[model samples]
Target: MTKELKESDPGSPSPNVLRIILALRKWGWGSFWSQLVLAIIASIILIATIPFVTRAAAPNPNVPIATAPSPGIGMGILFTVIGIGIVYFTAFWSFRYTKLAQKLRGANGGERPSKLQTVKLLKTGAIFSLIGMPVTLIGANAIVGALTIKSLTPQPTGGYVGVISVQPIDMFVVQASILTILAHFVSLFASLWLLNRVSDKPTN
Candidate 1:
């Protein structure tokens, strides 16, 4: 019933120790690494693509109805970056779970986090993801909508007037936003799973 009793995994003979070990060895690092890796990839995409989006091909002067729609869609890049930031924050919060797990493993009685504290942390992470989901969705939708409009935009008398048209890079914004959404979802799921697991324990 104390930290001194060493057990590496959840099959510990002691019930409370088993909970601590299971949380630490199973979901603790699970949440940390998954969120971290996804967030990093998403952020990199955001950084690489946002600048190009803003600098999207200029308006074709020859076309009378020269309306380059990509710039407007570029706005999604901003929103997606914001979403990525939120995702990063949540990922960091998820890391705290691992740290908390370590603390739980090494502490006993008053030294350990209360069930309330653990639940609160998990709930906070879930809420963060809930908030981020809409932001990322908005970004993804905007980018797709704008790109679609650009792709279908009627050209000047010619089939297509100029090179200032949709390109493969344009899709990167959508990919980034989607990845961010994925990261947020991962964080959200982990938080809820941990929350439920912690709730089932009868510890203060």
Candidate 2:
């Protein structure tokens, strides 16, 4: 005969939230690492391609013109890679927290996790997400700035040209930065919601 399973207390938290958190934690970190690696590779490829593309698209001129050293393309690539890492890290941590909560609840017989456990998980996820925000913004800015320089400015006529300007693409990058920040906030909120739900007693 199969042994009967013991029922959990009615006052305990819902198992669903715990399940969600557990799933997130299991897969989130791995996904983040993969994304980061891919982003870095893509940035490197883009940076390498920029010069080739520019050379191929260069207008042929019978008349010669002076040229100046361009801003470092490598720096732009680094920035993009860093930004992608930050964004991916934030997303990963948020999901990881949710997953951990779920796992704890499920492992503990569908009961609420201890206050300390919840606090620890929340603290870790929030800290990383907060740290990632500035890194992402700066990285995005660098990429936009680099692309803008390439698109708007013509080959230099004399000594160094100080500020290369591109209005439209810069605007798009700024908007994208705002969207990224919003995404972080949304992820944080979702993590917190899962934590709260898992900690609260079940309704029925």
- Candidate 2, pairs of clashing residues: 18-102, 21-98, 21-99, 22-99, 25-99
Q: Which model scores highest in lDDT?
A: 1
Worst 10 residues of 1 by lDDT: 60-69
What is candidate 1's lDDT per residue for 1-204, written digit by digit as tens? 346446655533356645755674467567667777877888887777766555445555663433333757767877888888897788788778877775566544336666677788889989999999999899898898888777776565566565346766676667778888888888888888888777774664
In candidate 1 the C-alpha lDDT for residue 81 amounts to 81
**Every model's TM-score:** 0.79, 0.48
lDDT of 2 at 143: 56
| Highest-scoring model, TM-score | 1
Error of 2 at 30 (Å): 15
Q: Quantify all predictions' global Cα lDDT against the true fold.
A: 0.72, 0.51
Per-candidate clashes come to 0, 5
